[model samples]
Target: MSAAISAERQHDLDTGAAASTHLAECLAVDFATLLQTAARLPVAAVQRMRDAASKGITQRMALAATLLREAGQGDVTHWQSHPSDTVRGWACYLIGSDAALDLPAKLQAMRPLADDPHFGVREWAWLALRADLVAAPLQALPLLLPWTEEASPYLRRFACEALRPRGVWATHITVFKQQPEHALPLLDALANDPERYVQDSVSNWLNDASKTQPTWVLDLCARWQREHSSAANAYIRTRAQRSLR
Candidate 1:
């Protein structure tokens, strides 16, 4: 199934016209039964649908995710461990948006996906859970803080990525927009992370917050440097302060 989308993407570089058309055709025939039984579409086509960013693709993926949510938690959980990481990732994506589930329950299911071997799956893990965090930043703080100390750098990065004030490919978090200080605990935890990936996320998180609170950012970075500066911390501070004019 992924092979077909890859072929379609190759055939159409500038747009996903071929991919969208092929996906629609495949959904109509080859995957109809599987979609009905599992209540989730193949991640291959879904990922393409999202990456393609076409209105047609958007509508298709939204409908599929909606169906998966309606199918019930047991069905979603079954698909969450599908052999294909793509399938599992889409499962995580669907469950992350389960409005019926409380935020704690939704995030609990998504935590494992944050450490998924596949990068895209991990990305969706954060993306799928971001809205709930944005809606209640204070609530998200305690839930997300533990990940900052987790052994996996990916999970540590997820802590920052999930709570960024101005995340990419998602809506801006209005709470952080007004009071970036709310993120200090998570930022402090990752100030000197050994992993470059984690450090980058921490820095980017601060950079995002800094956009609307230059003085606060400047003060925080200065205090961090004064209190405990290391090579990694220096790098993060430098990266975060780069755009503060």
Candidate 2:
């Protein structure tokens, strides 16, 4: 591990803190230690996660969720409310990996995590179900449309962020890349959103599409500018076309 990771591990060891306050601490968190100390997971369970670390975060998280299920700790509500963000992230994967839950059920279960106060938990929320969304974009898009009008900017951001054509740290949505217009309802709803957080997500969503559908992006931006000339829309348009320019 790097010195930075060592320091973070040592800090958690010394402080016995259950939750991370920022993204770096979230990334550097030692799951084995946290599961043992904060979550009171059994030594065997903790060791499983420790061994899983070598596979990296995504796989580790998936394994953690599986372990939870096998141990009869599959109640996502309990994990979701855990003091540790990593544990809450485990809840996301639990929901994601569950083959029993359909798309609507999964989205309903994911709503709270999608708007989780911790940034890391919020990211895992969308990332957890991203594959399912990609598998069924037609069903997912309409289901997520209402999220754009949600009261919290985080929920609004999740509506777009979760469906980005080429999101970071996740698989691309080929349907959006080839047929970006399918997602226009979502894009249009948030076009004039006041929050910079939501605006950034919208811009990045468009930017992702622009890579494969530049003309579509340009036309959409031009239409938005013509219909609603707002600062938020302008910012989104500018950033969305950054790659094309």
Candidate 3:
């Protein structure tokens, strides 16, 4: 941990706070110690987490989920409702790593986590299933389309954030890169979203595609502006074209 990490923030990271207030706190979390001390996980499970802590955050999450199952703690109900957001994040990964679940099942399992109260858990919700989405972008698209219409902006954001051709801290979705049009349904649904959170995700999704298909992004923005000149649409268009500018 950096010396710059405050004592209070370090305590939160050590004790596994419900949510991290900043990126540094989230990054500095000691998962092995957290699982053993705060989460009361088995020694074997904590050992595995310690070994995997050096890996990327995503990998650590996946390993934690698997270890939970191997330790006979697979019932994610407890973890999902845990006070610690990291534990809830582990629940998201548990759902993602379940080989028994199909894409639709996984989406259903992820719904609550995608709309989690904690921002960190919501992020883990999408990140947990990104690999599955990349493997079947076409199938994932139609399934995720309904999420854009969800009442929660978090769910609405996940619909776009999860399918970005070039998402942050995730593998690229080559299919969406090659065929950006496939994402039109989800993008169009949120073109005039009322929430800034959802709007930013929509624009970011377009910006990601803009890298691979600038012309398509330009034309789409033109059509959106022409069809619906709402302030929300204008906002999305401007941000979507930021890279091009």
- Clash totals in order: 0, 0, 0
Q: Tell me how far the alpha carbon of residue 196 in candidate 1 is from the true structure, in angstroms, after superposition.
A: 0.9
Model 2: per-residue lDDT, tens digit, 133-223?
9899889999999999899999999999999999988999999999999999999999999999999999999999989899999999999
**Candidate 2 runs further than 4 Å off:** 1-16
> Comparing 2 and 3 by lDDT, which wins?
3
Ranking by TM-score: 3, 2, 1
Query: How well does candidate 2 score on lDDT at residue 232?
Result: 91
Stretches of model 3 off by over 4 angstroms after superposition? none
Ten contiguous residues with the weakest lDDT in model 2: 8-17
Best by lDDT: 3
Clashes of 3: 0
The local distance difference test score of model 1 is: 0.70
lDDT value, residue 223 of candidate 3? 97
Please, what are the lDDT tens digits per residue for candidate 3 over residues 54-132?
7998889888888788877888787888777888889999999889999999999889889888888999999999989
lDDT of 1 by residue, 115-185 (tens): 87666567667777777877887998898899888999889888899889998777799878779897788
Q: Note the Cα lDDT for every prediction shown.
A: 0.70, 0.87, 0.87
TM-score of every model?
0.75, 0.92, 0.95
How much RMSD separates candidate 1 from the native structure?
Answer: 6.8
